[model samples]
Target: MNKDHYTYRVTWSPEDKEYIGLCAEFPSLSWLASTSQKALAGIQNVVAEAVNDMEANGEPVPVAFADRHYSGEFRVRIPPHVHRALAVESAEQGISLNRLASAKLAG
Candidate 1:
């Protein structure tokens, strides 16, 4: 996998009247451009350079979380009332609470 495949977002900035490019893996880094495409490209280029610098300096590269695999399992903590409601609804629908919740989350 490419180490430079970091998550990025391009958002419009009303104040600057430009698009702001941001990288999730490097919160401290950002770029601005008049167009969203330019913003995205600029941030990607910066991220590539940063990754190269890290490699040259023997620093650990940030992992791209979207590339990670996941089991269909995770834990969620809900209030007692929410938990009870979900369980009751699932029971009424004749489905497991996990499946019901998973479907809701998927939507």
Candidate 2:
């Protein structure tokens, strides 16, 4: 697994007063540093070490989000009242429910 392909995010932590680095694939692991660059590097190194240990233990490695395929279709359940309102709104706008929902989500 290419650790570089894993989704990494760096954000400022007001409480910690430092930049926090996070890996989506390894939610339990994190690194913090005074600088965003250092925080990112720290998290990447941590993820690399974790991957090495997991490999040595013959564990299945997580597939990076960048390496995974996504289907456009997904199912969502809404309250009946909300569903009826959406249906009415779609009709008022002369659009399909899926189109209205997609537009709302994208917005």
Candidate 3:
């Protein structure tokens, strides 16, 4: 996997008083620096090293989120009461249950 293709995010960490860089695909890894740019560079380097190590060990590397395909469908289990309430709401709005659920999930 191209480490650059992995999902990256930089955020301020109040507890550490530093900017934190994170990769979604490698949740266990993070980088902290005084500036966001350094934090992001640090995390990217770390991810590159990790990917190299994994490749050397013949471990399967994770597919980047950008390279993965997703269907519009997924399953979720809610309590019966919540299900009924959602059904009622969808009915009142004259929309299908799936549409209502999709809107709620997006919000």
- Top candidate on lDDT is 2
Badly placed stretches (over 4 Å) of model 3 are none
Number of backbone collisions per candidate = 0, 0, 0
Provide the lDDT at 94 for model 1: 100
Question: After TM-score superposition, what is the CA distance of residue 79 in candidate 1 from its true location, in Å?
Answer: 1.9
TM-scores of all predicted structures: 0.85, 0.94, 0.94
**lDDT for each residue of candidate 1 in 1-107, tens digit (9 for 90 to 100):** 48456789999999999999999998888899999999999998888898899989999888887877779798999999999999999999999998999999999
Q: Using lDDT as the measure, what is the rank order of every candidate, best first?
A: 2, 3, 1
Off by over 4 Å in 1: 1-4
TM-score of 3: 0.94
lDDT of each: 0.90, 0.97, 0.95
Q: In order, what is each prediction's RMSD in angstroms?
A: 1.8, 1.0, 0.9
lDDT at 1, model 1: 40
Q: Is candidate 1 or candidate 3 better by TM-score?
A: 3
lDDT by residue (18-59, candidate 2, tens digit) is 999999999999999999999999999999999999999999
Instruction: Choose 1 or 3, whichever is better by lDDT.
Output: 3
How much is 33 displaced in model 3, in angstroms? 0.8
